[model samples]
Target: MSEPPASDLTARARLRMAALRLFAERGFEATSTRAIAAEADVSHALLRHHFGSKDGLRRAVDDDALSAFDRILAEFDAPATRQGLLATFGTVTARLFGADELRRNYLRRSLLEGGAASGELFTRLLNGTRARLAMLSEGGDVETGAIPDSEAESDRLWEPYQVLFLMLGPMLLEPVMRHTLADPVFAPEALHDRSAANQRLLTRGLRAAPGDTREP
Candidate 1:
């Protein structure tokens, strides 16, 4: 098959962006292809021509949003020091979520609305978390001397979920959190502080190097 014309690709991208915005604002069931087409300044027939249906368009949007995290996840495929890993998390979180309101809102809706797509997204996140933890554990990137073996079984089993909750809590709650605290949680400075605090907490609470005295 021949490659699509450049104009066709541009129209497709516009439709996807429009769909993302509408879905974030009004949700999937409420938003229509016509509205998306109007938002993109394209015809409804063009939307159908590119993505077939609203659901197909949504899948395209989901795939595009998830691709960013896939790149972030790929960074963990190789071994790194515990701090290096944590630094990556901090940097990426600040960079990714802090800058992209549309993507963040889209994800918040997708995750909280509860659907097959949401479940799939959560599963992808869980798998990524597990892979990162495995790297930390198997590569001896972090020491778990702070945790006792007597309780290690359950901790090992549930750590990924726990970590994800910690990571996602602020993200999902960012709007409410910002309202309640009167703080911009995703601001660069705030994100940097949060990341630094996370690094400190993980370092002292879980991955302290030998004889390193750090107060939690």
Candidate 2:
């Protein structure tokens, strides 16, 4: 048998990554500890040693990802200007959909395939998004006259819940969207372009005219 090549990634990290990927693809109940160990190229004993148990491993992934999410939120500063709003939104959006496919997939599946866990995840996401928007609103970054308001604009505005639903739904259905949309707009490989496109739309209301009374 050939020896495995040397690599910098630790066994524990590999296990966590593998667990994340498998859990995202197969959901937590469907994924097995044995599969995680095999995917990580480590012994099952090692998995037990590092994580204590499969449930513990799941918690670890959640803890690690949430910790990173906290840092991402920390990057969102109270905006001093409309430009600042755009910059902050762009940064947060890109980070949410960053290279961490495991976190992204887990989040998407949790939303799409609802369960008890999905409710918890949604609560966390909704609170975080609301806080982010509130901070921006207070800081005078959320509205910049880019989109003229409706008569009841302030009262009729969809809250952060609606915003998150809009953001996460498409993300969870990306694979379907990629083929179904059949446009470069849905290109999985071109997230930069996609985010840029989103930025533009967000600045202006979806209405053909800024004063259009249609709901967004």
Candidate 3:
């Protein structure tokens, strides 16, 4: 068999990146392969040759995002103090929220739509998040004590999801949140500041209590 041509590979990568950005912005249904090709400055035929279909392109984007998130989560070290936990969460929040518009758009699509593809991506995200939180709890770094085993047995364990959501949900909801906050003292900068403050509060609230040694 012949090796794949370098130009073809480059075109495929470009297509994937373009699709990711567009999907993040316009969502899957709204974005077409032709639009992705246009965004990448490639041809529709080239996109189809590389990705097979729009669903295939979305899967690639999902894989790319999930891999990137895993790398970010892996970098998180367990925080040793309540303040440290707050700072760690703040750092994570900032990084995720700071993602380029395209990535944010793709995430929104996954959340708003529910089907095999979106469901798989959502499951991967949730699992990755929980695993990272479990690492924090295991290391005894999170200020919050080990979540009680009985409570954690629920399918929708709240703490991990709560933490992850607080970090990301605001960005997803920014448009609506911004409109809702359009009162006195509700400037965009102030909203961001308040969001940051809320992250700190959540970090502090989630920390293990002093003298609690139970493991998650």
Off by over 4 Å in 2: 1-6, 79-91, 94-98, 137-158, 182-203, 209-216
Model 2 lDDT per residue over 40-63, tens place: 999999999999999889778877
TM-score of every prediction relative to native = 0.77, 0.68, 0.70
TM-score of 1: 0.77
Which RMSD does model 2 reach against the true structure? 6.1
Candidate 3 stretches with Cα past 4 Å from truth are: 1-9, 81-87, 140-149, 152-156, 180-192, 203-216
How many residue pairs clash in all the candidates, one count each? 0, 0, 7
Taking the tens digit of each residue's C-alpha lDDT, what string does model 1 give over 18-46? 89889999998899999999998999999
- How do the candidates rank by lDDT, highest first? 1, 3, 2
Deviation of model 1 at 161, angstroms: 2.3
Candidate 1: clashing pairs of residues: none
Candidate 2: deviation at residue 106, Å?
2.6
Off by over 4 Å in 1: 1-9, 76-91, 132-156, 206-216
lDDT of each: 0.75, 0.66, 0.67
Q: Sorted by TM-score, highest first, which candidate order results?
A: 1, 3, 2
lDDT of 3 by residue, 177-210 (tens): 7566654223446546765566455444546576
